[model samples]
Target: MGITDDAKDALSATGEKISRAVDDAREKVSDKVDEAQADAKVKHAEAERDATKAKNDYKEELRDHN
Candidate 1:
């Protein structure tokens, strides 16, 4: 089945948040992307965790709204 409007919005917002985090991580690491690859990886992993939480929260919200 297709996702609900609310679910889509939630997912999009979560993605945007992750993208921003990735950008911030890149900026913080600075100058040499290769040297800072490890930090970038960690930041992406944390963002993934955050995205998972966001999805769960959205699922609960959908349940409540329904």
Candidate 2:
């Protein structure tokens, strides 16, 4: 009976450790996804700014020619 109890305790501890590890991994992945999304947003904003600048520059050139 003592041996059986010991085995059960060990199994429970191992399960808890595995659960914690899985949770940690899930959190890390979520953080990375959020970081990637933020980076994409920044890139999109930069592209928009560049396009607006180009358009304005072209307009200025037309005015100068006239």
Candidate 3:
């Protein structure tokens, strides 16, 4: 038989198992994406805070110099 026929037969035999596997894979990928997004947001916020602090400090130093 051709590959399509073989695949169909395999799906017929293991449809539920295959479906569960696909769902699990999708959930894992989604979780990883969400985790990465959250991490990026945290880093961005931290960088902004640090930049603001540095700018304020530099302004103070410049005023002292002047």
Candidate 4:
């Protein structure tokens, strides 16, 4: 015995749906990663700015003491 044309069609349709779902999930994950990367960059810049400000304040204090 052999499989019928209807069964093959149904299998093909299922495969297409699964592929689409996988692609959608992949896009969602990529978007989240991009957002996280942007957030990290902002945080790193803020930290650098804070550190520089603190260093300048310390240097000013040393000058005042001298």
Candidate 5:
């Protein structure tokens, strides 16, 4: 009975460790996804800004020509 109790304890400890590891992995993946999304948003904003600037510059050039 003593040996059986020790085995159960060991298994329980191992299960806890595995659970913590899984949680850590999940958190890391979520953080990476959030970072990627933020980076995509920044890139999209930069593209829009560049497009607006180009449009304004083109309009200015046309006015100058006229």
Candidate 6:
């Protein structure tokens, strides 16, 4: 009975540690996903600005040609 109780206690502790590790990993992955999303948004905005500038410059060139 003593050995059985000790084994049960050890199992419980090990289970708790595993659960904590899994939760920590989930939080880290979520944070990385958020960071990636923010980085993508910034890149998208920069690309849009560059595209607009190019379109305006093309229009100016066309006007000069006319």
lDDT of all predictions: 0.90, 1.00, 0.97, 0.97, 1.00, 1.00
Stronger candidate by TM-score (3 vs 4): 4
TM-score of each: 0.43, 0.89, 0.72, 0.75, 0.93, 0.75
lDDT of 1 by residue, 1-66 (tens): 356988999999999999999998888768577658878899999999999999999999999999
Name the best candidate (by TM-score): 5
Query: Which ten residues in a row are the worst by lDDT in model 4?
Result: 1-10
Cα lDDT of model 4 by residue, 1-66, tens digit: 256888998899999999999999999999999999999999999999999999999999999999
Query: How far out, in Å, is residue 49 in model 3?
Result: 0.8
Candidate 5 residue-wise lDDT, 1-66, digit = tens: 999999999999999999999999999999999999999999999999999999999999999999
Looking at candidate 5, what is the lDDT of residue 32?
100
RMSD of 5: 0.8
- The alpha-carbon lDDT assigned to residue 46 of candidate 4 equals 100
Error of 5 at 19 (Å): 0.5
* C-alpha RMSD of each candidate structure in angstroms: 28.3, 1.0, 6.0, 2.8, 0.8, 2.0
Error of model 1, residue 51, in angstroms: 1.0
lDDT digits (tens) for residues 1-66 of candidate 6: 999999999999999999999999999999999999999999999999999999999999999999
Q: Lowest summed-lDDT stretch of 10 residues in model 5?
A: 1-10
The digit string of per-residue lDDT tens for model 3 on 1-66 reads 699999998888798888899999999999999999999999999999999999999999999999
Candidate 3 TM-score over all chains jointly: 0.72
Name the 10 consecutive residues with the lowest summed lDDT in model 6: 1-10
Task: Name the lDDT of candidate 6.
Answer: 1.00
The deviation in Å at residue 56 for candidate 3 is 0.8
Candidate 5 off by > 4 Å:
none
